[model samples]
Target: MEAQARAILEKHHDNFLEDGNAVPAPARRVVGNFNVDDAKPVARRFRSIRPEHLRKAYDQLEKLFQTELIEYSHSEWASPIVIRMKKNGGDIRTCIDYRIAIQLIKLTHYPLPLIDDLLIGFESVLWVLSLAMAKRLWAVPMTLWAKHISVLICLLRHFQWTKMLLGLKNAPPICQQMLVNCLWSFVRLPASEAAQMDVDGLAFLGIDVGDSAEEDLSTLIEGMTVFGRNVPSSPQLNSVRGERPYICDIGYGTETWEQLCVDLDRRLYRLRYWGTSVSLLKNKFGKKRFSHEIEADRIQAQSKIAEGVIDLPSPSTLRDVQPFLASLNYYDEFIESLPVIAAVLNKLTDEQIRSGRDLGRAMEALRILKRKTVSTPLLRGPDSQKSFVIIIHANPWAACTVLGQESDGVFIPVHITGRVLHDHKFRYHPAENEVVALIRALRVFRAMLAGTKLIKVYNRYSMLKWICTSRSLEGRCRQLAVCFWKFARFSWMTMVWPQSWELRLPPPRDKLDQNDDNIIQVTGRVIQSPPVRLETLGPRCEGWLMSFDGHAKKSDRWGSAGCILWELLSWDVVQARGSHFADVTVNEAEYHGMIEGSKMALVRGISEMVIVGDSRIAIQQARGLIQCLKPRLRMLLSEFEDQRQEFKSIELVPVKRGFNAAANYLASKI
Candidate 1:
């Protein structure tokens, strides 16, 4: 590759640094009438050049004058020119300020001409143009005639050579070499004026004398239509010119598929299809193909290290103890309660401390870590054709999410990730933190999801509204929102409710009371998974009554919600209360209470219910009597409406605090 690149650069080396030859006058003559108005001359005073660089600048100006590239002018079009240091830091170069001259000239532009109109004029004499160009430049030097003959050559190249090369219908070996050589020599022409040196001053008249015409435009425009993969196979182009040997199958009773296999085997001895095996297939997909059976070597290595650490004698000095602790720390993710169990051993390793432990607690932690790792199930690799589903859980200090896909009628895990939210000053709301979890997970697995369908299954159902509708979030949350928008724009993505039965790997049932650790659960489990709150009712209940209430303290640190259900048949009442640290206002709290109340009713298979709340704003918003202009309130309102879909009818009624006393008392206590 490096040698080929050097050869290509050497081929075009003459096009670079030149002898400052001025382009001939014929190429510069504009072939159009200058009927547009001319502007008055504008002038500026020239600034003093730097004293040290004045001599170098003067020498450069003298070279330009000698080459006739510039002439002395006494017009009022003067502007300051600066001397700039060369890129190699060896010398200074002279530069001109053409701003005043540019301002004084009134530019003329013609309306864009249609290609069909020009093609009509050339339809009768296409061959005449090419022959005329070749005849005119036949006797002149290659470099001298290269510029003046560019317009004629551009027309011939675009109409003749480019068509022959792209269509793949020409006699290949001789024609390809001839056309390639002709185009290669054309690059030595004056490239700087190529774009403006058209047949006429009208640049958009379908005539481009630019280097791009000889180089890139033909390939770009002909890419899919003429030179694409599905073009019919030509023996001259593919077999002879491409240097691929032709293989023929002559057997009498063989099918085409059998003949292909036989020919391949004869030529290569053994035929192998790339990316066919399990390992190769996994690599082609570029996903995490986690499996214990396939990772036996890695597991064996870790097992040996663990056994060695276990058999070693207790360390008397800190140096001897450090290596063992380091080895155990590497496997901390698999260990449960690693920090508390290894606390004494970690203290012993501190540089200034001389104290030590008996290695009893460390041994327990290691044994547990080893056991857990041995029992851990291997996850499958991601499939690009399959849709991706992300299950997320978040809290104030930490967040976790699992990437999985449905396989064999089950949702199997592909990867799991979590991290501590270390930015303390940002103070992300719980919903915002959940959004952070989602964005972090999507970014981590972006490659696997490039053009795939993605579905986000969220624990906090209200978060779906914030992600899909709210446009007012700022700072890190807004950054996350943009990342989501980019992926959402190009891919098939949806935010939907998470079914209760969808959780296959629930959060650890044993860690219900360990809330202070702030450990993010990769699985869908919480602190004492709350049971479904069902309204206790009498037999054959006729109707249902819901009492909704909300609460906010004077300082607004947290908001509380309460809802009570009454079965009218036997006058039985069931009460439920919850709190939201993310909600800032009392009205938000009231909407949250109404949302949860509707959810409880839906879960109990109730068709209709009456929702009674103390906050008039919450009641009016739910009843569509008022619009919630605030972004967060609007999102909460959307969540309430989505939950309303599960019920036949939910009527909202506003009541005074005294009339809704039971639910208000429950909200205040929450």
Candidate 2:
């Protein structure tokens, strides 16, 4: 019967081998009981029906079946009618048991969903095959047949069927490769006995095995563990040194599949032994959860080691020397004693030390000497009699010296070195010695001038003249003279004369303008004051400016308002003030206001600048500390930085209240 079916298929295949439009005579002849070929004449009855016309013919056939004129049955002879309909361009109903054909083709071994997904283009063929498989009417592998049909459908859609049928059209190389791979995937193996197969059979269609052919089979067995037989026992397997047993049918050709299957069986045996060994090891040395107390103990030990509180012998040190070595906790004392120990050791020659019958006794003597030398006190005075002075170098050439005095009135100088000024050079001046003496004298004078007692100097005019002349001394000497006079006057005010007394002194004035050739006039109002109470102002009042000048054109007009702020404040906070000015741009104006406000705060010795403005641009700019980018604003920015150095700190704040009344008033007047 199979041979007969093959012959019939071959004949039909030849008929549609060229155009694919011609219906097989044998198949069409069995469509209905009526001998249409004989009655209507072959030429007329064999006329190919167009697809549109086939629909009408199918409807008529449906009517005939409904009227009981035709029967639908599970018989191969009944398939001829469907084939005739297909030949006539009609939609043939899928066979109810088409899966039987799929089984015969050996395509059922694969997962059905995978097969379905791969055969989406050949849905009709798959449907027929699925029906046959579900009904057990076919022994074919439904998945395998569906895959082939999918390739055929793809080819048919891409090229003319007529050319394909005639052999004039060739199937793509991929389609042929897929068919060969599917065939290899279909080969069956016995239940107990393993079969050899190629790696390609298990791989997806169109994939090449390449150098990973062996690995592919191993991976396949590992993935399909449930399907494989029990593994063999071996020490290699137990140690995970051997491959697992699982066949990978990943390539075409009979030999490849056979080799793959052989590899799979061997690998599985090894994997089984490995799994068992792993289980045994795990059971023997399994991890256990510790109680909180135990965990805490472990953590404490770890932290001690990390912090170097617990000493572990150094890994790089000689093992024999480890026992004799002391803990590193007394590092300072240990280092201090090393030189003394070396000196004592040098006195006794190595031969003499070795000659000592007991090495321990010799080592003990050396240690005693080291301890005595290092433990000796360096200072030999009472604690109250000790004094130290710290000299902090602010610049390479200058240092600020602060002295410490003992109860006996002895002064000691302590040198100060920090990361910032370690490499700095300071030139000691004679004035430093004078300042030190003056500090000591001031202390003694304060003690003698207790209460409101005042002693008039024998030469008061001469002393005043001397002090005034001393102030004119240049550089370090000049600074020293000023410090002496200031300290003396401060002592007088606080100790000698309790009443308000003023020494006649020159009034402070701005340095004469150096650029007399290009003098420029500036005009502005007193827009703001230092943000501090008068009594709280203290020594800072001397640096504060009463007003800021806004000039249109000046020799220093190129400078930024921000830079001017820094110059006036003498504080680093000026950098934090966002300010700039440009050529009449709104951004420039806003930036200028922000910077100027910050500078005003610094000049007033205020910790914060509260900038209040109705202009949204100015408010946002001030709030964000935005800088102006206009070319004209660069100079303003420079000026702001120059003026910022006077204040200790400055902060920016936005305000909507009348607190900025002065600034607002100035803006209006401008």
Candidate 3:
């Protein structure tokens, strides 16, 4: 493979392979194209030339000349060239500062494959022993007109590339399109190639570019695509991979099925954990449950160190270090300490080529990462009906977060993550760090936590709002405050002390200060599992009771809302408000009436009141039992929260429609 790569480099180093034939790109094929937004031609003078590196810059120009990659040009468009030394100090790189030129570039955008979609399902589990990338873009020829955009001003001499080169923003999508076309034209076996199979079955084909007919490494078909036992039930992309076991009908495919099942289960578990409204699938999931604690011995078999996967003997360059880090990054959400364990490798990313090569330290970090990946505990699936618990821990070096949920009687982890602090982050106040950690975790787990219940412990829920309102803060804190606005609805909450707490538990059959069979059955398993509520207490004001209801005709866009505030002792109405709405949902009308009732209470200077409503969803949201996620409802809830501050104590009570007839009649009469 190495010899084939060297041969390709020597022969067609500046050529792209043709899709039709197994030969070098025959002509100047402009796969990627761009147009200037305006008629003006952009030009800039050469800059950033160092006195000590002048000779190396000239040597780089000479190398490009010999490779025929660049030629003299008289184009009006010119980007300045900057010179920098290579990490080894033996060579120099001539780079272009294309900032100004990029302004006029009419961006040609194509949808590159998303990393999330690529890292999901069957593709992520495949074993890849070796992977290499050759400079295939060099073969993509530049059009005569487009070549002007590539012109660079070096020492007042303008030059342009005859082939595709770095610094062009549109090169990636163009190269992707060309490679896709080439693969589509490659020789492919029939999907049902049952008759073409040899008696000994099939062997995976490993292909090399620029290979001859006499070579054993040549696939003859021109390229290699990893084939599996059976097509996945879900949609999949054709990704290149090394040799893996294939399935045959002769009872030999059990291993492949077993491995696939494990991988598929792991993926589904994560999807469930990350989803906001996941429900338990009775038929798909068995009665099995994960332990509250993670045990290394119980991890799945596939997680163990596979033969060739984590064999990081020695990686001398950042290029070598990056791919392995990317492979481990797939386990980021699964392993909490990933950022900490790989801190040294992450620290090594910006190091010079050979100057900071700590092979021993890097290898040790990689080895630890391998073990961490294997020992990661399985996460509990999310339940939309249950609330989510977020426990955040911050130290000097890192911030860790754990997403907790309850199943049956025990609490289990849904997801775990850690973010290492470096540079400016280390200078934050301790409380500031905690807020940073909280907001970061909230954003990452928004998919699961949004529109779900969160524990409103103390004033922590309002911390974000406080930060946003604060006047004394640095630019970083202000930036975080700006980002916090995007997630304001997802994190809004408040708290109530235990004295004001109201809970309804099952009545015990027998109790003598002991957990009798029928009495003490309630096991206080998960601490935050109970559904606690609050009610108005320890307050002396007008005993006001507010009942609200909304009415809408069948299939009508108009509605009416009514609210009545009456003295609880006399049962006499003190004030009543009715409003009609157009093009509003029933829930919206109900909220309108609820808001009207609160306003009336505030006008009467009522410090404590009980609010009753018939709409269950709006009532729950007002009582903090559920989240208000809809834009309109969220706005109404915010307005209600603002008005709620005027009262010393308040409670939202829900009643059946039949029992709220007084308010209903008032609404329908409007």
Candidate 4:
């Protein structure tokens, strides 16, 4: 602990040394820049005033300092005027201590002893003020006493003289009102009655209010503007100065007044600084006004309407369509002035352009329609019965058309389309493709509902791509929502593969059997074997199996046999791993194989795990149906039990089929 303390002190000492070394030269440079040499004699002469007058000046300086008119730290020579005046009584030691405390307080990095001492001094003054005000012994007005208290707080806070006015202490209402008035006066802004009421006087100065201070100040300013009369009186008020004084008096001395001016200047400087940065800050912090955004949106909607009208091909020759195409350019310019329409237009390209003559005719038809008309005939064929009609829906975003037929009376539907497009030159550009796809989908869905026997074509890939990229559509699209739910429901499905079948043929022991023909027969037999089999053995068979066990009794006491089989017959198909017949208990061997298999599945990142064991007891134990009796078996059971949770879904099933291929394969290998 001592070493730790030493290390911390050493670090701080180094920092102090670095700071102290840099201070003197800079201080001298600052004093030199001010050219204080000529003023030194005048200051010295004034310093020798009679003690009574000097004390008065000192009191005024103290009040001004408290009000923060002039910063003592920034004054020439390293001492505050309050400390310098104390030397007049020749109390050299006290004066030196006061000067040292002031200097120490001025060092921003140093702890402030002077502030603490000053607070103690202010506490004594507060006692005096309380007694004087309580007794009504002083001739000063209650308002004047409050104003002086306000000046004192302003002085203390402004000069970092927090010691003299600790934030924890509360001042009288008169003092509080006076202080708030003084601060507001420096702000060069009028105060509303509500603001004056809410200022709560000294409460504003107590404690660090953080961001709320700024908010409260802003509220006060806003209230003043909303409720109070404007400054620098209007023309009508110019003739009424005698009746209504321009400036009202709030109690403050000359020193306090000077300090208020200085404080006001500082505040103005800060406000200007903030004003200079407001534009950049607004770009980051202020949202674009909804009115401007909505106007842009409306313009875009109009452009989409115009684009749909102009893009339809003419029924006449291609040459006739040229006029309509030319007219589209003029319409485009007019629509572009509406920012919303311009935004949508900027997303268009040549590939999306349809027939201009059809669009122009559609627009002309819409214009000619009466106020009550729901649909307008746009294009009339030679037969007159055949015509293309534009259908206007109440919704601005929904408008469509029907292509007419003559004999059969069939009308093909045409829907307005828009999309967002991207180009390599400008990646991720917002074009009209998405909106176009949405229009097509809506049209198709509508046709389906209307009992139209039509195969509705849609841009499926684009829709799916949008669904995958945008989270907004994920909640709305049924197909995508179902896919996500399925993925989550069967989490284990992601980690494990379903069962597959593989033939297990033994290696040929004889040279003749090693030939391809004989090998094929063995392989065929292996493939033809039943998937599952249960064998009952006599007691003598157990000893024989132990003799054939290639491992030692204790060492081979626990062993695992595994086989992989594919479920080909059932819809709930799966891959299975299990153990075979052996000297070892089938249950133990099966459990071991399952544990090993689960680890492999985890490594492979399978979302589900399935275990198929021939032993009902083993399966029941795994599912927590039967408890293991032996400690060793219990330990193995515990380890193998929780493999299910590693996957999204897990299931245990018993298979009776000779078709249970995985277990059969394992038994045959044994």
* Winning candidate number (TM-score): 3
Candidates' lDDT values, in order?
0.46, 0.28, 0.56, 0.30
TM-score of 4: 0.17
What overall lDDT, based on C-alpha atoms, would model 4 receive against the true structure?
A: 0.30
Residue 231 in candidate 2 has what lDDT? 34
Regions more than 4 Å wrong, model 1? 1-368, 374-377, 393-396, 423-427, 460-472, 475-478, 488-670
How close to the true structure is residue 620 of candidate 4, measured as C-alpha lDDT? 63
The alpha-carbon deviation from the true structure for residue 667 of candidate 1, after best TM-score superposition, in angstroms, is 53
Model 2 is weakest, by summed lDDT over 10 consecutive residues, at 129-138
Scanning candidate 3 in windows of ten residues, the lowest lDDT window is 245-254
Q: Indicate which candidate wins on lDDT.
A: 3
lDDT of 4 by residue, 279-386 (tens): 111111111112111363332234444455545543333334345444433232112112112222232233333334223323333232211121221222323323
- lDDT per residue (tens digit) for residues 1-670 in model 3: 3453344333322322223212223122224456775558766555646667777778777767676777999999887776666768767777886755555667666556655444334332322111112344555567777789888887737888877765787777665544432222222222333223232222222222232232343344323321211122111223322112111000011124344343323222221111101112111211112212435755453432443455545666677778878877677777755665565566564455367553455556677667656553557778878787665544444666667665554446688777877656656655566676777777778788766645321222355555666565656565765754543234334432232111111112122113221121222111121332223322344488899998766587798999999887667899888999988888889989999999988888899988887788878887775667675676577668657866899877777778688999999899
The positional error of residue 273 in candidate 1, measured at the CA in angstroms, is 43
- Residue 215, candidate 1: how far off, in angstroms? 45
TM-score of each: 0.27, 0.15, 0.41, 0.17
Segments in model 3 whose C-alpha atoms lie over 4 Å from true places: 1-30, 39-44, 47-68, 80-89, 92-94, 103-106, 123-134, 155-157, 179-297, 300-328, 337-380, 383-387, 393-400, 406-411, 417-670
